[model samples]
Target: MDFSLSSEQREIQDLAYKFAKNEMIPVAHEYDEQGKFPTEIFKKAWELGLLNTCIPAEYGGSGFSAVDGVLICEALAYGCMGMNSSFMANDLALLPIVIGGNDAQKKKFLTPFTEEFKIASFCLTEPGNGSDAGGIKTTIKDGGDHWIINGEKMWITNAGYANLFVVYGTIDVNLKHKGISAIVVDPKSPGIEVGKKEDKMGHRASDTRGVRFNNVKVAKENMLGKPGEGWAIAMATLDHSRPLVASSALGGSQHALDLSIKYSKERNQFGVAIAKHQAVQFMIAEMGMKVACARLLVHKAAWMCDQGERNTEIASYAKAFASDSCMQITTDAVQIYGGYGYSREYPVEKLMRDAKLLQIYEGTSQIQRLVMARELLK
Candidate 1:
């Protein structure tokens, strides 16, 4: 099997790498410290056509495959995961429409992303519902020509600045997953409230906020699919998205590893460089191994998606393994720096912080294992 990237893929990878190194790395620390969204950097990425890379060509997107998108994410994430997340949020919000929406819906909702740099959010998790997506308390009531939606969504990325939202709510609480439906809502719609931005542990530069919809009105034409299709749309979107998440984690792991290696060789102890010590050598070795393995898993899952394969199991495997690996690798990177690693002045500390949210969002590592188990059993 060929493992090499095609020339076009290599070009995309190189472009992303240069943009990350030249633009993102320099300002990442400042954004994190200020807890502000990197709007300028995001605009640059949008100008580069880095956002909405996966929308079909007919919609004016480049129509890059999942594998192509993964490559871009890994490179961009290596510079700053928070910034990468801000850019990637656009894809997460648009995928459901790409997967389920009709041509007219695509023209209305998806076309804007191609013509302009507009942000969109996917609203699913609530204050009480994260892993239990089917248990969301949001309600969608039929309102003749429109739907009235009422609910609170927590941990919504891009919510603070999003122009539109892809919201999921239920027609009846008792119907569980079957009651769920997907709809698009304009962020400026009446009764919509965007709460304060979250003070997160990592990805601080990526906008995360609470959104409350109080009897919000949504036109019937905004429905993604027929009633009861929200669950399927949500699950399918996650299956496709998990690999990109894994790629982001892989990028963080690689960045941390790079820092550790450079520092180990430059810093000296016992009258010699730390890289000479077997203990330090071993740590570096393990970090390298984990990054490699995680990349392979992420790529395999993305490849499966591009090939039109149902990748629920492999997607879980990639997300779980890559995120777990990233956490460990980043931690080890900090250890390699000793006291300096613990300091906020160094890049490794930031890498460690960024590595954390990868495990929690998209799907927690524990939730991924549960998904894998169910897929295996079935």
Candidate 2:
């Protein structure tokens, strides 16, 4: 029955929001306009223990829980989701290692990230693959003392600046999911090429590009679990990280609501404040409800993850509903702002554009529905 955040959670929330207000909000538009990654902001966030918060203390990390992660994500996304994506991609890239790596593997791969400001990219979706992970054409083969990888991964976030890449490939394309394996790769390895940065429609502040592995060599010890176990590892990674996506979307929705409420009260329309109009009130009310429900769903999923429970269904529910709702909420906010909302000078326009990628990534709303259906049938 208690809905309050624990004292620890509240303190985490305060620290995150303070950083967001001080650092992210002021420069979000500047970076977005230039389509540049916020390196300074990221360095500051890292200094504050905001970036890469989940690696265990033994590995020189804070070992924060899933709920703690959601709180930080929401606050950062509220400032700017584009910057938040750069942060979230680290968690996305690292989750597979935490879920499937042995002690030695974890120590070797994850420890350096904590020691300094670094970035990583998750390499799963291919040039021809988006929702269908099993349809990937990438290949990873056994070499005598090492592993060899060859593939082109598309739509990889933080690809341009990543120091490390977590790659997924198949031993035999005919075997599909059964042939899949996950391996960690050094981006500096020979035969690796990073394509030109993509000119994206939104989240322009995050570096994204295609990565081609001609014949990349990786240490044999870098593979996570056994050869056929990658499919499960990928699935588990999604289940755990989907809520983080939901939290980001939730933050965007809350931001849209806050902006709308402020504008409605200040803007005079027909000789009175727009807040006095019933039509405006209705839209505002709907926006408020969307924010409230989405927060509940987002938090529930994150809570389940921290408890080590099976949350595949709830995670999908949160990611789908929260992201879809964020798009709606941002769009409606623009509507309330009328002509001004469409212009780049105002913040809502960027939010509306940024809100879009949330639905498209981390599993589209349609894909999440299918996941829910499959789980229900089982």
Candidate 3:
């Protein structure tokens, strides 16, 4: 099997890499320290058409395949995951519409993305429910031509500034997953409250906040897919998104590996470069190995999506394996840097912090395993 990127894919990858190195890397530390969103960088990415790569060309998007998007994600993530998340949040919010919305719905909800650099958020996890998506406590009530939604969503990326939210709520508690429905809600609607931004351990430059929907009303046309289809839509979106998440992890791991290697070669110890040390060499070797293997799995999953295959199981595998690998690789990178790695002055510490969230979000590593096991059994 061929394992090479096409000319177009290479072009996209190179573009993203240059942008990340020149724009993101320099300011990543500053943004992390200030805990501020990198709006200027995000705008640059948008202007380059990097922000909405997956939307179809007909809808004003570049219509890049899932594999193409993964390449871009990996490149950008190598520079800064916090900044990467701010840009990737646009994809996370819109994928559901791409997967489930009708023509008219797409026109109304997605066309705006083509016109301007607007942000949207995916609202799923609540204060109490994370891994147990079916147990979400948000509730929705039918009001003839409209629906009234009431709930609180936590850990919502881009919630602080999102113009729209793809919300999930239950129509009947007893029905569990079957009762869930997905709806698009304007963040400006009455009674919608965006809480304070979260103080996170990593990805601080990406906006994360609590959103409360208090009797927010939306037209029935805003519902994505049929009633009771939210669970499937959510799962499908995650399946498609897992590869992007894995690519982000892969990028961070690669960055960590690159930093460790450069530092080892330059830092002298006992009148010789540390690269000559066997122990340091082994660490770098392992780091390189992990990054390589994770990239294969990520690209494989993305390829499956582009091929119209049932990728749920492979997506879980890629997400779980790549994220777990990144965590280990980044940690080892810190270890290789010795005491300097632990210092905030060095970039490895932030890479370690950012690598952590990869294992937790999209789907926790444990949750990914559960999903894989279920798919295997079937």
Candidate 4:
């Protein structure tokens, strides 16, 4: 099989890389240190069509394919995963709409962001449920022309910064998975509260918080797909996004390896550069090999989805393996730096901290395993 990127894909990746290097790299450390939300940079990125990309061209978006989206994600993430994730918050928010929203719903909600920089958030995880969608306790009740929603969402990215949210909750608990429903909520609506921002372990620049709906009213027309289709919509959304998450992890891993290799060559030990040491050389080699494999899987998964193929299994595998590689590579980069690695004076420690959320956010490594097992067993 051919493994080269098409000219269009290469252009997308190079443009994204240049944009990230020029814009995000300068502010990555400051944002991480201050845990500040880089709103201005986000707006700049939006102007470049870097945010909310999944929205179709008919809705004023650039109309990028899944492969293009993943390529952009990887390029941005290579500069800094935290910044890339903050920018990618738009994709997580809009993927469900692109995958399942009716034409009217898409036009109303997805079109506005393409005109200017605006962040959107996806609300799925609740206080009690992280990976289990069926455990969602949020409820939406029919109210004639509207629906009254009551529940809380935790660990939501871009919560405070997002103007729109794609929210999931239950309409009928007795129906279990079929009882779930997805709706779009205006973050500014009355009774819709954006909780305090989380002081996370990493990805500090990405605004994450709890969102509460206390009988918030949503137009019935904003319901995504049909009632009882929330679970399916959520799963389908992940089928598209897991590859991007894998790309994020792979980017962090690549940066870690690069940093380590450069340091190993320049730092001398026993009157010779540490690069001559067999152990350090072996570690760098393993990291490079894993990063390459993960990058390929990430691209393959996105390409499969763009081709309209069933890639549930491949997506899970890519995310699981790539995220694991991120964790491992960052850890090894720290080892290569020894004392300096564990300190804030060097970038590896920050990379290690940033790499961690990659495993937890989109789906835990264990959850990915479950997805893979289910698909394989079937």
Q: Which candidate wins on lDDT? A: 1
Off by over 4 Å in 1: none
* lDDT of model 3 at position 315: 89
Higher-TM-score candidate among 3 and 4? 3
Q: Each candidate's TM vs. the true structure?
A: 0.99, 0.98, 0.99, 0.98
Clashing pairs in 2: none
Provide the RMSD of all predictions against the true structure, rounded to 1 decimal: 0.7, 0.9, 0.8, 1.0
lDDT of each: 0.93, 0.92, 0.92, 0.89
Q: Candidate 1, residues 1-378: lDDT per residue as tens digits?
A: 999999999999999999999999998899998998988889889899888877999988898999999999999999899988988888999999999899999989998889988998999999999999999899999999999999999999999999989999999999999999999999999999999999988899999999999999899999999978999999989988999999999999999999999999999999999999999999999999999999889999999999999999999999999999999999999999999999999988999999999999999999999999999898
Model 3 segments more than 4 A misplaced: none
- Candidate 4, residue 230: lDDT: 92
At residue 176, candidate 2 shows an lDDT of 91
Model 2 per-residue lDDT tens digits across residues 1-378: 767899999999999999988888888889999999888888888888898766878888898989899999999999899999999999899889988889998898789889889998999999999999998799998888999998899999999899889999998899999999999999999999999989987898999999999988889889999987899999999988999999999999999999999999999999999999999999999999989999998899989988899999999999999999999999999999999999989899999999999999989999999999999998
Please state the error at residue 148 of candidate 4 in Å: 0.4
Candidate 4 similarity to native, TM-score: 0.98
171-196 per-residue lDDT for model 3 (tens digits):
98899999999999999999899999
| RMSD of candidate 3 to true structure, Å | 0.8
Prediction 3 global C-alpha lDDT: 0.92
- Candidate 1 clashing pairs, residues 3+ apart or interchain: none
